[model samples]
Target: MGRRAALFILFAATALAVMAALSRPGVPQDRALAPGPRGTGPIIVAVLGTSLTKRASWPDRFAGGLSECLGREVQVTRVARANANSRWGLAEAERVAASRPDLVLIEFALADADLTDGVWPGESRSNHRAIIEAIRERRPDVRIVLMTTNPVGGLHRLKRAFLGPYYRVYRDLADELGAGLLDAWPRWPGTASIPDGVHPAPEAEAQIVVSPLLTLVAPGFGAVCG
Candidate 1:
């Protein structure tokens, strides 16, 4: 790519992040992580997240999608808890880094987790950055991918509005470090199959979460609709 193209992409990505922060939401905040040299060797994909990553969740589905795209064996390890909070992530930071992942996806949905407390994300942002620093310490070459999640429903549009800013933490981090991102919130393709609206249903996972992740890691690599 030419210098002009690279700078143009950066500007576009930053603009997209600003737009998502200002308007839509799901996909990571920044588009700064333009595709780079892909890993040709076997890969270890680690996910540090909350409920969205647990009990055979997005991490699991993305593993399958990435495998087909890479045309090689891939291992996915999840460090997730059900509350969709970042507390457990802080506790297990070492374990996450020990996994030595070539790629890492991180999200906590902190703002939407406890709307009763309001949309304060100061702690949420710092803790996640600490986790990223920890992982990066061990593997400097690792590609960290920030992914905003599905739109919430129980609270309806309100929950999404509250949660959108929190997702920006990941986007800003990605931009600062020049990492990868999925930006699932605004980009998610379908309806909330769940009654609560916060968690995406299984079917929604395949289309919104899994397929897009596949497309990100490996373009043209089709994801199976689970």
Candidate 2:
């Protein structure tokens, strides 16, 4: 095919892929991650993960944007620690559940893949399951979201050789446990460079993290273009 024809085909394929991704059934529609009537109270959001999440101003931005989009207040509580993994998160699951949030976002695959931590795939999987279970036990109506953050590269990538498997834990568990997933890993490289090989630069955060999440939870809200 000619160059122009090939470019057209690629663009068409890309559009189709995005459509397919968006069409996939996420958390139940009845739950509607957005808040209730105008008189109702704020939508409580709890974000639990590693430093990547702690640093991701996306949640605050998301809450603000979502509140505007849905015409309701969104209160966000972030419980994340640097260098922590799913194992550490499991210990705090009860605290998170006790907060009585309407929505919970979890991201820890990167930290779990740390070679120094040596949390194997199986153990990581179990930890995630336990954490989810603990939360669900208390708040059965909560809408949980699992996030796979930016892709790692350079020496950081080299160290976390099992990072792919670690990320899959979120995807698998999201399906198994009936949760939403913001699969940001595969979309990162195309969006921007992770100068540190782990974290996305400040400029890229809105696109790499916030955009897709906004698309997931609140469709039609103006997304941050990459």
Candidate 3:
């Protein structure tokens, strides 16, 4: 072919290649890219616990963190109360069963201590097991993640000492149930994750708990780590 003709052919091939690249999935286009896997459906995360979960800021922060990580809308429903226990969490789970959430974060370890008084340790375990079983029965496909509470300081330590067995029960339940566990205990000391030594601080909310928790929930959630 002549030089001019060859040049024209080369230009045509380049244009076609560019077009093909743009048309491929996940490739950015001038108009808009197709929705990613995360955008396929809305993720409903139900957080059940005590005052820590009730903290308006915690859920909001978690929502924001999940949104950033998943690159999709994250709806968080906080079914929590101040000074509540595992029984409350179980009730909340039962109520939420109908809603059919995509994920459930059980934050009742700290509250479980309260059950030791009225309920025996074995009975408390049974109650917690019943709750998990009920949730699974209601929504077989829903994912359950156990969230362990942060360690308490000073007087709160006394509560932890009493509640230690209950906390262990929570861990045991998670293991036996084959549920994902997110323990926020270790992140407390070195990092300033907890504000009043209970609820997560604003800074810690995004970095420590929110980001890591979502990452554990689903892969590729680490994209929101920054």
Candidate 4:
């Protein structure tokens, strides 16, 4: 074949390969597969966390995004307290189970790492396990998701001295308990939007928090996009 024709063919083949790679079911592409049904009735999602969840309203956004992604109704219940940590979450586990959620999203690493809170890494791990066990005690079949939320900045970073260790507790426990995890600390491009150095601003929440959680859980629920 002529050199120009051969080069053209090779370029065409590479472009097709790239296109095929981009169209994979798991990847976000221009066209997405239709969402399949997730049983009957709206999905019950219980979110247990600290102020990061209570204030930003990502759980609500996640509910809507998930509904669209899965083509089903998604109802989110947030059981959160400002400055509460995993230790506090243990107290609310029974309440979370009482809601009879099909899925539970737990985000407490941020608060648990607080020096003033005094949770530390060991206690955080224990609290996380207890919370998971408490929820599963009543609802064995429920899907549990653990989240290591946003990294702190400026002064807040100083307060959370053991932040990395606390976040590791969630990451480790997620594997041990066979639950899903959204390790969102690294997902933040920067802390510029976190005015408080902890909670994500409204505009940044959807992209950084909600989208990644949806992407993580969507496959398990039998769908794509979040």
Number of the top-ranking candidate, with TM-score as the measure: 4
- What are the Cα lDDT values of the candidates? 0.67, 0.74, 0.63, 0.76
| All candidates in order of TM-score, best leading | 4, 2, 1, 3
TM-score of each: 0.73, 0.77, 0.70, 0.80
For all predictions, the C-alpha RMSD in Å is: 11.7, 10.2, 21.9, 14.0
lDDT of each residue in 117-221, candidate 3, tens digit only: 335568668877877788889998677777755655545444444444555666677778877776655455532445465565655554556655655666423
Query: What are the per-residue Cα lDDT tens digits for candidate 1 across 1-226?
Result: 9999999999999966674465455334434334556446677888887776774466766777677666667898888877656656767878988888877888776433465643357877777777778888888877777777766654455444456667666677767766667777776654547656666776666566676566565532222222
For candidate 4, the 10 contiguous residues with the lowest summed lDDT are: 24-33
Candidate 3: give the clashing pairs.
Answer: none
Which pairs, if any, clash in model 2?
none
Ranking by lDDT: 4, 2, 1, 3
Segments in model 4 whose C-alpha atoms lie over 4 Å from true places: 1-37
User: Model 3, which residues run further than 4 Å from truth?
Assistant: 1-39, 114-120, 190-202, 220-226
Clashing pairs in 4: none
> Per-residue CA lDDT of candidate 2, range 137-179, in tens?
9998777888877766677755775677777777888878777
Candidate 2 TM-score, C-alpha based: 0.77
Provide the global lDDT of candidate 2 against the true structure.
0.74
